[model samples]
Target: MGAVTMGCGDSCPLVRAKVREEWNIPDPKDLPDDDFRKIRDLIEQKVTSLLAQPTG
Candidate 1:
């Protein structure tokens, strides 16, 4: 099992993950459209990078 956390901190609870990753992205709620798009793009880039990694 794998886990990806997006800056939720203590409000989120994830247990016993075989692979865990925490991405320190800002909360985009109520942000301006431009800022939201930038955050979204960052998340997309991070995901793309992760996917490009070779898995065991």
Candidate 2:
């Protein structure tokens, strides 16, 4: 099963979250600094947008 449908592990199964999302972003560990920055910027933008949402 894909990660989106699968549980994280034994520990996380006990709790439920209101929202669960997977970004499917690549690991920038061994990449060039420029590439790393691009991914980082993408994550920042996503987080910024998510924070802008109204939580009720």
Tell me how many residue pairs clash in candidate 1: 0
lDDT tens readout by residue for model 1, 19-50: 88889999988899999999999999999999
Expressed as tens digits, the lDDT of each residue in 1-56 for candidate 2 is 11122323233454576665567677778889999999889888877887797876
CA lDDT of each candidate?
Answer: 0.85, 0.65
The residue pairs found clashing in candidate 1 are: none
User: Model 2, stretches more than 4 Å misplaced?
Assistant: 1-15
Candidate achieving the largest TM-score: 1
Candidate 1 scores a C-alpha RMSD against the true structure in Å of 2.1
